[model samples]
Target: MGRNTRKRRMPLATKVTAGAAALALGGGGLVWANFYASAHEDGGHNRTKSRGAQVATINCPDVGQKLTKVPRKARRGVAKELALLDRQITDAYTRLAETRQAQAGDANYVDNAILGPLKSKRTATLDRIGININRAGGTAPRDLGRFARCQGVPVDQPGDGDGGGQNQGGGQDDGSGQDNGGGQDNGGQAQNGPVADDFINIEDVQPNSRNLPNGLAANGDGGSTGSFTTECGTNENALRNSDNVIVAPGVSNGAQHQHDYVGNQANTAFASDEDLANGETTCRNQGDRSTYFWPVLRIQDGTQDIDQGRPGGGQDGNVGKIVAPTAAELRFVGNRTSDVVAMPRALRIITGDAKAFTNGLNNANTAWSCTGFEDRQVTDKYPICPEGSSVVRTSAFQSCWDGQNIDSANHRTHVDFVEADGTCSNGFQAIPQLQVRLVYDNIPAPRIENGQVVNPFAVDSFPEQLHKPITDHNDFINFFDEDLMNQMVECINSGQDCQ
Candidate 1:
């Protein structure tokens, strides 16, 4: 449960899109669709077409990202509305998956039955969001309806993360990259995706190809150079859930994917700060009560986990056997140019983009690699580790604090990655940079059978994100006691590797 593996580089990045619409393949086998629309009139790329103009999943804009400065009074309401938007997309995608045959014959079936209704729902949600902001004495976001319309983009290739990557392996057994139009995998299951292309042999990745994103690492001068390590048991008790208290505080199954928790015990979507503060923790140091969690990694071997029939599991397109990490190492390091300050209590930070597949790579920070070949990391593709090497996921969090609120309207502006010179910009202050390393030694290496990847491993994700590696993310909520917080800051600033 311990390692010297440093959380160094952020992963290489690529963007994919999610759309909503049932896609089907005839002839008793899965056929790949080629047309796709991943971007929107709002931003990114334009929609593409194919022989049949097929789309794989939903592609509505992420409203949460747009509301960077929601008034404090309206935050709770806006968060609920955003969660509703997510549910609308999930529902639309599920409906699309259930009606592929009708889509094949009626060109307008997706528009009439799914996209149109989805837009209407989104429009209402957006309007409510605007009302919340306006009533709270804040200016409402203009053109909120622009994000209402979603596309069923069918990108040009098979197994691409075009929201239609619902590729069935050659066994028509796996869905390829985002086909959003109606990608089907083995047994013709829709939205259960992450086709063969989502993976790559770790050896194929170029040596030293991965770089530290946004200059996250420090220059090691005039800064808190020490470290603090916490002995949090590796989710040994099997504490797992799909709720995200940071993003969707009161909504159940807001993530629509399972997550592995290693620290705090009372971390459900409904738990309030009071509950978390009083919650039992798994960390050896009772003072360090922070909650550390990430999407559960699963092996896709035609099996299912306990939550298979639950909302965040199979019902949300996550189908497989869950694998707990062998080690969950949480380390706190110092800034590159300054002494560190204490992270405010109840501080929440989310690293990486769970919707990178559809929201683009501007905020993406996913790092994937093998145990020994950690130097070469991949941001966009899942690494197929060698025989003895285990799968390693590393996430280096933002070390700069805004010096104000612990939470933000978007849950991001409160923290920022360091500038190129490793110094915080504006009035942002240096805080302990949390570097997390999670090791998976039990997951079997994926195999290629009949030109398809068999038993591939994937991270739990929102259904439309298509289980792409770029979408892997982590969440944290600091519940450390004041003495412990001060201790962490002192240990980090004093150049000591204390536990």
Candidate 2:
């Protein structure tokens, strides 16, 4: 848990307080679960749609010795800011590697756990970088700002020669042969297109089926509400649960739902041209008139490691019991409710397979009886179970059942990845007052030198580690086009440059 230190530079007044501090507003506020709007609403999703099916290129910005010789016109103040930003980026990489290493031993790490920390660090770095850009008299890095509101920000610059996009390049190979740690500067101009065509309308999906409550069955207990305490605490405190835990609805059988939530209730998700595009969103529900802030709530599990995630006899057929702990396992465990913990349920067609949905979510899930964080057992006061025992995450993000990468034409309305930096404009400003959709993209398929796609599953397949694409959107249809389709095929055939 890294703490932020606001260094005392020149007089606070000396810091540029010009139009919009260029910092992403909304310091630390909780957003509802309709997290898909932020990215899709602004330029991120616009980029996806305007490209019209072009392969997404992942690029790292230039960070070589170029910094050693700061631009002659670059302000001295801006220079220092850039230097600080540089160190922060390096630190982010280190932290990301550490998180990955911690989970390296776990077989069930395929859910992009390692990337979680990386994303957080990336967001922070993006924020700092955006500030530097504004201080340097540069226009905002439009992409960064859009991401901050939704998916979070990105650090590296656009990829080299990939049409104004960042390339994931590390610096030169030393004599000893270590790749120096700077990104390359391609200096390519960002692609320009008709600005009017950048976005898709999300209103068409109003009363989206994803909003219905299937994970929390109707027969179950009603959902509960509460607040978390990441606000008044240190970094360490922010790492664990500081709120009340919620139990799964009684009708849920303490498991995740397998099929779509409300999609079948009515086919509101795919009614118009605007509904079929791509976009990005953070976890704020603008569509529903609810009071919930976050889409998911995760109560920490104190146990270090639990037995391989296999449940025993229970009302669901397994006898609930506890197990041991592992070093990688964090603290707290709990459940969720439709009113509070809302995530876009992957399935939309009900097809009367309720049993299939339930079983799929609870598969091999263990209980919270064995090891409890602080020896605390699961209770109504804290809907989460103790570590090593029967446990559930109180939020949608933490639930095993909440995650599925379904992007068929019907499922993927709009989706985009938002970086946390303030460079990109916020979706709120772009679309103002609308419901949004969000999704995460798994690592693209591996590739050959010629940039052809390789089988992701064949490359590496661990149920816990299986990767899939997660796209976010307000208007879902903005992402498709001949360019994008061709690029997607190219990316799958050759993962080299595609994200």
TM-score per model over all chains: 0.87, 0.17
Candidate 1 lDDT over 81-160, as tens digits, reads: 89999999989877876777888788888889999999999999999999999999999878888878887755333334
For candidate 2, write residues 119-173 as lDDT tens digits. 4554665566456556665654456523321111222222223222322222224
Local distance difference test values of all predictions, in order: 0.74, 0.20
Give the number of the best model, judged by TM-score.
1
Worst 10 residues of 1 by lDDT: 1-10
Q: After superposition, how far is residue 202 of candidate 2 from its true place, in Å?
A: 36
lDDT of 1: 0.74
Report the C-alpha displacement of residue 398, candidate 2, in angstroms: 12
Candidate 1 TM-score to native: 0.87
